[model samples]
Target: MAAPRWDLGPAREPLGLIRALQGFFSVFAFATLGGFQGSVSFHLSCAGSPNISVSAPFAYPFRLNLATFTPSLTALCNRTWARDVHLVGDFSSSAQFFVVVAVFSFLYSLGALLLYLGYLHLYRGAGGKLPLGDFLATAAFSFLWLVASSAWAKALTDVKASVAAPLPYCHPPAVICSRDTTTPMGTLNVSVVFGFLNLILWLGSSWFVFKETNFHTPPAPSTPSTM
Candidate 1:
């Protein structure tokens, strides 16, 4: 029945800071990984034709197996080239999983921050249910970040290998193919770093939120009896 009171005190506390960081880093984690667009180049040389360069472009949800690149020349050095050359690997599952977790973490952290800043009284008055829910959500996010980041890291490794490896059609004796260049994945690497950082922040904040719950209260000590 009372008017809501705004309090800035919680924003200065450790839990609030952690939530802010979780939201901040989550933006970078998903943005970098989701907005990523890069390509792998290959140089082709045949017995007598001029050297040809081709690049296969790949983007978010990185299904390399579907990426296609056409060489400049249809027929070169007495050999015909496929119009649509595809790269290898299907890493969409792991990449998407990582992005999804980052996105959700960002949304949850933002909402929690709002509640802490504008609805502190209501939160405190929730009879321990709010804190218990917060603790559980924090723990769940910590675990999710771990799984998503680890899976994405491994998938990224395979993606790099697939891009760098020579193409199957180039194995013929008449043609030779070699890697030319690979777009830098520095942003993606940073995304992984942010993911783990979020994991650490969420894991650390769990303890603080747990303390607010009744479960973390110490049992009352019984008075010692003396005769």
Candidate 2:
């Protein structure tokens, strides 16, 4: 009679909860450059217009000023950890959305790594040591936190401005993912990429913890008698 053994885990982080709420959040589909987050294609946009530059699967007819743009965006995914791979700039409106997504993506990516590591650590406990991936991961997190803080501040300001406008309560510049903005969302995409990366990192960490704590271990083999 151990108190009926009815227990629930603590509530998860708000960010994680929000991320889970979004049914279709995935870096793979987004990174592949051939998908849509609702009406907006996840493709990078022309540097300063509402037009798109590159389409998914990376073919020709759908390609544009590669010399100027393509390299910059794809560079973020160099398959190596130490290099600065993200393409920076809020070129076009669509590009701008990618920027937002990119910042978020960056955060999510790191979150994935951390969460995954956390899973290993929890599973093995003392045996599962997370091989000190401190440098790059730490840097990514620090940078993400700084950028996120800045973004939140700016977003708050934007909210104030929007509310002051002869419009609805706490209105955020409608169609913010567009070029027509009094406040330019230039690095907006960059920050967002980082944010997404953080989200992924956090998720992976959480998963690691779950597998470690909740996974059922098989019964141990019985020892032979030493008569």
Candidate 3:
């Protein structure tokens, strides 16, 4: 008969804790997503041209590696960002995918923070609790992030291993191009760490919701006596 109303009930202890942690994660997510410097770098060198280097912050998804052309091979390499050092791990699609995952992670974590704050300030007085919809959304996003982060770590490791050999393109005939990447483990480690943390947070929040739902239900109204 009535549209489902927003939940407004006393907050559970665990829910409060979960919201606090969500806020913390949002801040760290911002740092790890774009603020932190990426360790991976690219170095490209061609015959007669001096070596060029491009370093990027953590490839949360992917970073474009660009090298400048020297005066010697201005005609060949050119002085633009188009010349990519083609290597196993120079600019892989998997790297870009990882960045995508990280972006979504940042957005969702930030959303969690806003939702928590909004509920606390605007809804708490009206007995508002974290709605099932919000909880479900968090659960879904967290699960996907967990999987994406795991895959990103694995993919990065594979790319690192595959790029061990030198390329023929980096020679006299074509163009001498090489890739020298910095530590790939930093991004992987951060992804895995937050991935697991988010998973646990979602699970804990779910369990708390479940407990509250079952234990604090309102009693059904009694039937009226017959005249």
Candidate 4:
């Protein structure tokens, strides 16, 4: 079977438009929600640690889980990049994770939606060369999912420590982290969830789009057929 063309054909303009539109919207959304701010993407809570936890209010001593793991946990916590914070809403953080997860959650959703649409259009439209734009749009969506998922996974933890006493607002009544976060109906939470599913959907869509991309990517110039 002949491979697909990478030229993007006549659909180039439309596909490019899609890519540009998505990029513009993503940037706009992030900017609107303060997602661009580096500091906004983290949350912090230190229940234990003289050497591990950061400067948090209402210090609560760490409770050792497995004595053997104490040193490992401490090492993880003390990692220099563990500057805890949150992107969407202030959530407690035992580690410097989830900030990007929440923010990219929204971004991923956008990517998934676009990639799906792009595939639909690419297949449904008249046969033409798909331009670089086709590949670019699909690529962006895939990347968005990858980023959001990584951040999301990193932030997952079952351990909850009351690292903060006098439970402050948005603290989940425990040391969820020292970040000011969502209240269920809050805007940031909504956006983050949206981004999460968006990423998930995009992952699904991206797989298909990648297939479509490959399906359409032209085979290398055929050597003149031997007589």
Candidate 5:
């Protein structure tokens, strides 16, 4: 008797959803458009008779203008200062956070695209059965992305705090005071939001794969009749 063959079924909705999400992530990661791109803006102001203000805008993955404080506030107050006080914070911390997000997203997106090709008949035209190796890879990478996204979100919060927190020189009794500082956090916030969205989608895909593989079994081959 001939051995049994694995039966393939129609593609599941969850799998298609996962493929769609993967494509979306790939675009965002490569283009760095929509939520992936962000900028930080800081304004320095000294409180005295006439308020003096200077604004600096910083783009992510490029330059980060944390906090620029004019050191020679006394000179400015006395009209003896030739240049504006310069204050800056180490932007490496936040830059690193964004870099990690971009790199991982790109990698995950590429993996997902390859898997999609396999499923769509573009690559190997693999059947509907979810392979064990693929499942394991998906689960592992999904978890990694989840954790990274969470970290990215937390890092954004930290960046916001750092932007708001007064620097050492700006302590009370200091001539140069940080009158007001604000950062448009929409870009980073959107990235963090999408991260959670991707995490949920990945978990759902994993669960679907697990159920399909565990509950459904291919029919066994029937014995051949003797002529």
Candidate 6:
């Protein structure tokens, strides 16, 4: 067989443009969430002692429960006062799920773009199967994006709550502890936005893909003159 002809025309169409956007947003969604590294800070003060700074660092796959923060030894609060302080919850599951979905979406869109650009003939020759398959994949990813984004959003809310709540160790008598600051999660917030954008892109492309499938074909007109 002759080598498949390369065509750039499809790359300019709505379906192709949407696929490109999906791939673009998918990259940002995963990168922002996966590469995140931040910390929550606190202030510790005991009666007659100056305030001490403590920080608990955390990164992607946010298992805050595993993260520990210990205050520096002060004259009033010695090593005996030092203890591992853990944040309240584990949100790794939702974070990982969101990142994984975005990564797979990027890979799929990249492959689909290659097919549209380099193997147009083969895709068209697949007897409606290719387009139907693409439509199904698009629908599936749309649902996945909805689920992953929602779950991650809820998880992020819990993460903020866990960080903002007073540390359990701060409850002792005469020893005062309070949250100082938390590294902003702007990147992760952007990730959530991109995730929803991907969902919209995939859903919008589904109509174009469905048009190519047999399911979307209009029925033949009736032979009215036969009467």
TM-score of 1: 0.89
Model 4 per-residue lDDT tens digits across residues 1-227 = 33443444423443334443444444443332333111111244444432222222211111112112112223343343233321122223321233343345445445534443445455444243343344465566557545643443333222122221222232332233443431121333333454455454444544444444436554457689888
Candidates by TM-score, descending order:
1, 6, 5, 3, 4, 2
Candidate 6 accuracy as lDDT: 0.84
Residues 1-227 of candidate 1 have per-residue lDDT tens digits of 55667787887998788889889999999999999999988878786467788888999999999887655435654545655568888999999999999999999999998888888787777777888899999999999999999999999899888877776567545787778888999888888888888889989999988887878864457899999
Q: CA RMSD for every model?
A: 4.2, 17.2, 7.1, 13.5, 6.8, 4.0
Clash-forming residue pairs, model 3: 8-127, 8-128, 9-127, 38-57, 38-58, 60-99, 61-98, 61-99, 170-177
> Global lDDT of each model?
0.85, 0.34, 0.50, 0.37, 0.51, 0.84
Least accurate stretch of 10 residues (summed lDDT) in model 3? 64-73
Query: How well is each residue in 1-227 modelled by candidate 2, as lDDT tens digits?
Result: 11222212111543234333222343442343223121111232233335333211211111222212223333422222233222222223333343354456445544544343344334234332322242234344445444543554354344324322321111223211222113233233333444455455544544433433313333356899999
lDDT per residue as tens, model 6, 60-126: 8999998877544333344334555677789999999999999999999999988888887877677
Off by over 4 Å in 2: 1-183, 212-225
Better of 4 and 6 by TM-score: 6
Lowest-sum lDDT 10-residue window in model 2: 58-67
Best candidate according to lDDT:
1
lDDT tens digits by residue: candidate 3, 1-227? 32334333322356656755754664454356444344444466644567666443434343333322222233344443334333333434554444555456556555654544444444233232444445566667667656655675676566555434443334453355656765545644665576567667766766654443313554456899999
Model 6: how far residue 15 lies from native, Å: 1.4
- TM-score of candidate 3 versus the correct structure, residues matched by position: 0.55
What's each prediction's clash count?
0, 45, 9, 32, 4, 0
What residue runs in model 1 are displaced by over 4 Å at the alpha carbon?
Answer: 1-3, 72-83, 171-173, 218-227
lDDT of 1 at 95: 98
**lDDT digits (tens) for residues 111-216 of candidate 5:** 6555544443422223424444556766875776677676666766666665555534443332464535565666666666666666676677777555444234
lDDT-better candidate, 1 vs 5: 1
Per-residue error for 18 in candidate 3, Å, reads 1.6
